[model samples]
Target: MITGGTTVNGTGVFCACYIRQSRKKANKSEASPEDQRDKTKGYSDNEGHHFVDFYEDIGKSGYDPDAERKGFDRMMNDARAGRINMIVVHYASRFSRQNVNIVLMQVLELFQLGVRIVSVNEGEFTSNNVMDLMNIIMRFEAGHNESRNKSIAVRGTFEKARERGGWLGGLAPFGFEAYKAFVDGVEIQLLRPRKDESKVIKWCWETIKRHKDDTIKQGQRHPGSLAGLVHQMHVDKVPTRGARVGGAWKDALWEVTTLNRILRDPRIAGYMAEPYGNGKKAAYRIQRNADGTPKKYGYDPILEPAEWWELQAWLDSRGRGRGLTRGESLLSALRNPEDEPVLNCACDKSMCAYYGGGTSPSPLYRCNFRNVPGHNGNNTMVQHHLDEYVARRIFARISTAEEDGDTAGFLLEATKRFARTQEAPSNARERAQLVTERHEAAQHLKECEEDYKSVKDKGPATRRAVLEEMDAAETRLKTLDDALKALAAADAPALPIQQWINSEEGNGDPMGEGSWWATATLASKRRFVTLFVDRIVVYKSAMRGNRWVQYDASKRVSITFAGEGETEEASEAA
Candidate 1:
């Protein structure tokens, strides 16, 4: 029997036995999930605790938070709601191997709720004992350290494998197959070209290379766009590689993203590389040898490097950086209801927004899908007057002092009332950390740039080294910037209206919320439009002459507000 004030002669105490296995492959050990479950059950039975439920997470990492683990989430919810008096895990690590902050927060919450935690191997954790709490934290730290060490080891092993030209074990790209080979009496995974699939890949490359110049000349017919080469391939019934499961393949359709990957992949040029980072910060380039040339692998080259690079250049030139951005006048929010995105062209393609070529230079949205078969009709719209009309309606919807002064005051009061109800120190710390890290990254990035600029008459090798360092610093700064943005998104607390407006630093206005809607940045207004407006549908009037004219009152457009689904119609004045 436990000596703490809490009762442990558990006749009525509900015990939630939790078990976790980090991998599908099981080792034959006493701590194995099955053995752990049996031991926990037996212990609960011996202690006379009422076994209410078992939460088992198989093939799930211990370090993942509750949101990622279904069983663990349900168990925590039950404990929080007082549905269970105690939680029993095979060991402390099974509860959590996360970093101290995350693990301690969950444990402290349970302790505060008068819930007991027990480990089958280590015994119960009594809330009143500081030593028990420290021991629990120490055990969790051990687990966390083990996980970190294992991760480092895995990365090192992978790096060595990369050096050896061995496959790092992921889904093979379209035209390749992962196969096992014995090299130096050790079995290693290697990628070899798939015969039937390789032919399709070669054709895609050849066709793309042949059309590269044409694509550059007329950006709309480019292979990078959906309605361009991808659509053409779909029409021609070109067989693309499919997903493989259990040594079986299923038919998959071609997509521009996948096709772009094939075109950009250096592996098709008989090289192997590894991806680093995630999202827009990700980098993938040719792996290099000691002599500074690309490392060659066993796979056969499907396309020449020169043609592959040319195709890549064409694709890069057509990207968003080279074109008219969304901030341009008159092209905002225009939509075609039949498109997959509904905001693009009817052919489910991006429309090139530009000023008209002739004297007037009015804003126009031109769909490049004219080159696509069955989509040869002109998909153009004049947007000169549409911009002002949309702006008027959107401005009306924005919370202004004139429209909802009372509601804004009420919201302020409500937020103040609820301000003290939930204060997350962890969130505050995380935000502060992000802010500090962002500043440091910016400072370091500036220093790197200065260093690069200051270097004079340097050797090619020295200059290259400095450039690489600058590039690394820039990449790190970008990563930190992304993280800060993400943190801000997650921590948008409902502060008072005045506080919300003044959150933007360096503003002189003491009470800016009154005029915030008007003075808001274009990016902010764009976000507001996205939130409040569902879609803007544009239509053309019957042409008086053979050629279509600029915007006039006859050209109809409708702005549909989001929640209420109310649509307001407007037209350009003749």
Candidate 2:
């Protein structure tokens, strides 16, 4: 192939070879980065172009155009800097397998700058001729179709593996180790409890359990406050479970959030969860069987299901007790409207609830910021009235949701759709299959359109056949397009708030099941209030129509509270 000092043909052509192989569950046996680089370099050498550099992204997908692929970014930078005249790859698919229009746009960007692309397998792709460019796009479309097919196939493989209790390979979670075992004479990887790591996991649970008991007996701190346990672990010098296999053990201090995550995970209760998608699109949901019980994958249990549920109870109870200040609020886990952090003043700072002062006695939320120099007025509102108003609104939303029957079914369907996307074809072979189908369908439609455009006065039967074929092909393309869109719009985990609303049996009104807001404990009320209400702007009027006259009993008070992203959160969570 491209040996040392082999190129001398294309005098002014500086070629940068691009190579990519997605890292998501890919094996070294499949088109390794080195092989791609070598093959691309050889093509450049044979073409007699100056092989300037190799731009490579190992284990990165070609589907996401905005993904931070280092090599791809560098290649673009070099092209912008005029460091290279030609971009070479084993195939144009190596450049991208995203939407055809998107890939064409990127190619046009370089084309405008006088840079050429060389797909070793397909030859040069240039905008020099309209026909040549269309041909190049056709080749790219084929690659795109292949990419989708491969993605579908990969997802199917994972789904099959999961169903058959296969490991579905990934990094072992906190107290577990991924081990290979022979099952029916075929080796399969699965998670097993690591003795040392398991001890740490047990310690976390045991410590919380002990605290739970202490709280029940003494009526003090709750077991869910994990920051103390985190501190204790640090004091005990417990090593963090970073990377288990071929990864160094870290001295990282554990956090309450980590404890929160661990306690919440169904895996701790001897279950398996398969993670799919990435970033904001990611959802690490429990893989369940048809019976709604968590699916098993040879995962060793860290805690009994009952104990795990108990742990979750403790974790969810954090920041919900007596003597909690406005600043110390719980904004997670609870579904009751009373648990949201809703108390705020017109000044934007948190309003402190205070008892009555001198003359007119009433419980009030006083704007603490009014004491500051720049602002004026002792802006205060009756806490009971504001709380009632906010609570009513929350219940109304819940009631509306209830009126829209079978929200659970809709949500379940959405979740299922999301799960499918998560399992989208991830490997080259499967991706090739999916994308190839689309490309063929696309090509068939392209041909039909071309034929339609080029048609002359022909026999009625032949013309009718062409028209029917074109309509069929168009329908097939639309179906494929819809499927791709479904894959791209991955589902997020259903938010707890929506789940709670669905679970509750309510009359779809404020005073119905939503009446729990009235009887909720102060701590729980504060927690719920924060979820939607931001601030209650209080205004005091001294007179009815005319004036700034001194008034006490005659003073009129009006309160308006802002809804702090409850709707947005509900939409996202759902």
Q: Pick the candidate with the highest TM-score.
A: 1
Go through the candidates in order and give each one's C-alpha lDDT. 0.62, 0.59
Worst 10 residues of 1 by lDDT: 333-342
Alpha-carbon error at 461 in model 1, in Å? Answer: 17
Model 2 misplaced regions, further than 4 Å: 1-11, 24-54, 63-84, 90-93, 97-114, 119-149, 180-188, 212-225, 243-253, 272-284, 288-300, 319-574
TM-score of each candidate structure, all chains considered together? 0.48, 0.47
